[model samples]
Target: MQITDFSVDQNLKELTEHRTVVLPVACYVTTISENINGYIPLHWHDELQFIHVVKGTANFQINEEPVAIREGEGLFINSGCLHMAKDENSTGCVYICLNVSPNFVVSHELFTTFVSPYIQATNLQYLHLVPKDAWASNILESIRTIEQYIHQSQPFYEIEVSIELTSIWKNLVKNGIQLEFKERETLKNQRMKRMLNWIHQHYAEKILLEDIALAGQLSRSECCRYFKRYLNKSPLNYVTDYRIQKSQILLQQPQYSVTDVAYQVGFNSTSYFIEKFRKAMNMTPFEYKKYRN
Candidate 1:
């Protein structure tokens, strides 16, 4: 399939706009050096994802944990996990990513029996697949085969891809049945999602720490703890970063002046916006706009 970038909605749900037409699977190769930011931004989706590093090492954050996968290594991200990745070194990192929908991979009865438990397992956010482990190696090989099959697009290639995917899923279940189910992690994830959604929705308006905490039903301190635990940033810091992120998009358009873009993204002071933008991006908003053009 063709390579494509993805966007998320206010609630951080991936829009799934680039899946292949014939199947509920999307396969693409990503070269981190080619991206303006050299990383994929944090996002989540309901589809299961498999990623294989093909070149330099890739560093990833899955939920609250960090993982690094080197060349020839792979990772399995469970459904509903918040994740992001970046090139570990300045050198380019190339990887193949496949996102598969459970419904498309199995019948309803089979999905209930095989997929539901894993998807709902809060303690099992991700699995790092290495070549040394037998089961993980098998899954990795199956991923490679699926990537080949999709790239070739031979007759009945879809069926071949389906078989490989099933094999990977089987390996995952056979090896992952022992993971403990943690309801607390589930609740934590839910609260974090609520707070993040609130931030995204109100990012263009005046937002306060108490306002964000209220959206997640959290006190000010608990809200700070949760943000630090999951996102490694304070609530106000996250809001500033998000505002800067939004400003990047607006800066790409020629019609908006720097001050206009700054205010549009919730920064009340144009000078303050310029300072933060420079700190985060290492360039002024005007310079970034010029660079983009």
Candidate 2:
């Protein structure tokens, strides 16, 4: 609930710490807003995820391509896919993100027959469900229904939630397109995940492109190209942006001065940090802290 710094390993697998948030049920639902940081940084988990854009628009970068879901639209991200979410145009958006562990959904032996092929289809990173389409609208409604039941928490809500999920899986298997896995895609994802994990680990230190490349075992040029191809940002630029975002949590506290927060998040130059902070947040650190309070 505190929206703590992301907990991930060298492989970029988020430790979701589901034990605390998801103790009673295998499913977890929450809403995300740009105010939290404007983006959910690249991370992956073993559970399946569904996102419904309730207001404004959300841009989800899955694998590498960006898919924009407008209000009333929904998206499904398969398990183990590298992805990130942000508000489109920073207009502020509200989206429900739900993660359901595999164990919760595949209770019976026959369920595997329905879901295994798609999960194994490495090329299918996500599915965008638009309300205008017929089958997609049906899936969208099912997601909404599940959300409603979870929020209401009436008696037998769990049973109702499972029924809706079953319908969603059945429809997805019937209508979803299968992606063709290229020879290099698997290796590419692995390399990207490793690089991302390394960034998350050492962001508070002075990290260079060479250091990030080492995590992925690539040369400097190769690393830049890889990030450009997948994340569309240079390694150093990404590191700076990440450091600025991480500084927000510190800024929210009263004890850490602006300069201290900047240095704590790996920014060596306070002036440079303020410039980037203003560029990303449209306010000075002092202004943001005062406004937040």
Candidate 3:
């Protein structure tokens, strides 16, 4: 399998790289320490995903809830769920990621009955798969087998992989039907995504708490509460963090001086920007730029 990095657009939807046009599926390995931020940034996609931790432990924030999957454990993320992952131990983490389009796995008739319901179920955001559980173990094993088949590329591997994927889907539907419904939580998650998207788009501008709340159609207090709940930070803090992240890219360009990067990323004062950047990255902008170069 390919080792790849993730890229996302303004809406935070991941631009996934597929293995083949016909299959609409991709399997790859990623190391948490290798990412730009030492973690996978928050993003979502329409495809369903399964992640198996191969080394160390992976800490994930899925739809604002924290879940940890250790070595030999796996996780199933529903379609379009906002999620991010990082290494829990700080040593590093190796994991296999499989992304598959739901439509490719089932026929139109079966999709309406067996697939759409689970994908559209707001309360069913993710499932943490552990090897100790019989059913969960079966699913994890199937995921491993699918990866092996794809990597080996033997004759009729596509057909064999399809059968394995279909079996996984059946098991997911059978088990996920029991989760309790919580439409309110789902709506909150959607609002949070809207606010996050606005922050990413407007990070280069002077953003206010009111602007963020307005983007999400929420009251200022509600906005603050949601940001704290979902991101564990105040809205303004999140904005500062985002601006610092953006500034790191501009720092790489020799044409842009430290002062220029600070202003470009919405900081009015270079000293203030340096202060924040150091706190977040443990290095000043100039130091980081020099190290990167």
Candidate 4:
């Protein structure tokens, strides 16, 4: 599906229009809606983003690193990072997103004068993910500076804001750790890879455990044992979960009826799809569509 038609992209555009992309200069506020679960469906951007969880809590999967951001905390997402955000059941979330275009930042005088001193020794390409311990104080301090600029907005407060933003990236790369995807369990090493690969390739197709076991080169019983140990769910359950995720996009789309969506996501029976969707999403297909609207 074209991502431009997707809700996340629309939300990002909305934020951009509102001047939340960056602080007080080229930045725009994409959104500040309440009662929203932070689970923004996946999207990408050329500009880098620093996502602050100002209120409530959020769980995110940043390319397989399962990290949680709490109130007053935030994440330093790299440029072009494929990330997903979901705030769990609780009060609504409000995030202050600071978007920075790397191209503009690097070419601008601000980067060459003040920022060049930091990246001089480093060869960092990806956006740095700032873990809590890695310059946590600096991260919090920068958020404060941004908040001050946002609230005060005095003459050229933007320049002060820019300095804080630069400090975040510079200190992050200087002190932040490069995080890779969490390693698969040692016990199910090979089998897990096969199953994950299969799921990724065929999430939209009807999947079965026997097929998964065969692909993983394990007997059904062994597959059941090792798969759950590593992935924390049964093979069939995992596939159902993936299908429900596909159903979410269809639900969000103005086109596609519930039945069409069900079948499109690989379910054969509408009743079964409704039941599964309700069980997974806590809302039936029809209700989900209405909610999206």
Candidate 5:
């Protein structure tokens, strides 16, 4: 019943279209949470990121990191890596999340459709995530530089962050790899496309206010406000409707029971699940299953 309104597809499409010169994230925002059990769910992006956990404990992993990050830490994941954040069910956390694109550094490196291996005769197109030094002062300074860069759209903003990021790379990414992001000149788009992509990723999980806040990283409330402004419903309802569509394929499977299938598609309560299904499909899961057969 947490349905509101937002168009996830439209939002991203707009972002993709803005091929800016100094490509930093819209802004630098921090999320501080006390619940150690809070999970960001699994996700990935084309942009490289720097995360500084200011306080408490956090269990974070970049692809192939081989171990979860312990408390009192930070991480710098390379571009286009599968990453997620969670708590150890022990302590709260305050972390800073920063994102930068390859174009933000090297604009000449246009994102190519074909992968290039062996740049210097070795099989390599991108780099891997790795570890760096943990000098508290350097981390603090680097974080500040990024914040400053975001505020002033001045000349050489990209250059400033690039230098600091290099320092951050040497200081934070633990046993990591480095790969540059691919850039394309003709990829500008409308906002709807981005929204579609965002919604596509987390539709199966238990999406929440923060979940859809990711629609554009607009604060959870703003995400709802903007979503209501455009798409006319909330992000939760957006996911539920999408889940119902995806469930149609599963409902036909004889292996599923209505209740079991509802949860599988992301409904926690069978009753609420049934209500949504009926609201969207004009029938409960039972009827849907019967019809499918």
Candidate 6:
């Protein structure tokens, strides 16, 4: 089943539980599309997540960095990371998201030794798995094999899945993704989370740099630097892009005029809104609405 809603307080979501008595596995595979809520909201979970782009492109916001995982590519999200995924280009995308329980690998020392550093370290928030890269190719193959085994459920399927997952970890270690932890990373993550939530809450209003800085308990200059470092964009730039994204949803409704949708999403000028929308989407609002319909 696809998860459509997430709790905003802790932003912690629980994965689907399998009905296994002896060898319990908390892994789940699901496809996301417009049929099942167009996008996955920003949320975090204690378990690690693997996203395989099977059919189309997936735009992932891991922490605050925007990443695009195209078809045949994949990404690994560390445990307890703030993340969300949506269809890129609004073409509609389908992908497999697997959430694995950390407990499942606790008994395996090999897996823990190779993977724990990347998983547990707050700095190593996520890893993008590209099929063209040697090590990442191996890891993606392992994930595909595991997905097949879980669905096929052949004899000794559990054993097969476990072995494949181990292979993935081995390749991950070889790729040098494992790194030492920084003690300050945890605090940085908390501050980012607070600022992100505040942006999401008030993006439709007229917000200032001072308001955003205060949300993270930082100075205005620090707030600008923080977003630039992590998201590679200024705070206002992110807000503008977010407004454009939100406008896409509103535009799908035939009754809403382009001007009305623009203002509703916090854009003061309709012409300016159209310009930004065109730059980001490469199409005018009317053209986009017709295409989407």
Which has the greatest lDDT? 1
Task: Kindly report which residue pairs in candidate 6 clash with one another.
Answer: none
lDDT of prediction 3? 0.84
lDDT string, candidate 3, 34-94, tens digits: 8766678778999999888888899998887889999999999998899888785785788
Give the lowest summed-lDDT range of ten residues in model 5: 1-10
RMSD of 1: 1.6
Q: Which candidate has the top score in TM-score? A: 1
lDDT by residue (tens digit), candidate 4, 73-178: 7776555444556666654666666666654444366666544443322223233334456575686677657766767668888677767766776677557444
Clashes of 6: 0
Worst window of 10 by summed lDDT in candidate 3 = 1-10
Better of 4 and 5 by TM-score: 4
Instruction: For residues 216-270, write the lDDT of model 6, one tens digit per residue.
Output: 9999898998888766789899788878877888898999999999999999999
For residue 208, give model 4's deviation from the true position in Å: 6.1
Question: 73-151, model 5: which lDDT tens digit per residue?
Answer: 5565554444446665646656666766544533345223111211211112223222244354476568767767756
TM-score of each: 0.95, 0.87, 0.93, 0.58, 0.43, 0.66
Each candidate's lDDT (Cα)?
0.86, 0.77, 0.84, 0.60, 0.53, 0.74
Off by over 4 Å in 5: 1-22, 32-37, 64-66, 70-72, 106-140, 148-159, 166-293
lDDT of 1 by residue, 81-109 (tens): 99888775765788888899877666677
List ranges where model 4 is wrong by over 4 Å.
1-38, 42-47, 80-82, 89-91, 104-135, 147-161, 174-239, 252-256, 290-293
**Candidate 4 structure lDDT:** 0.60
True-structure Cα RMSD, model 5: 15.2
Worst 10 residues of 4 by lDDT: 1-10
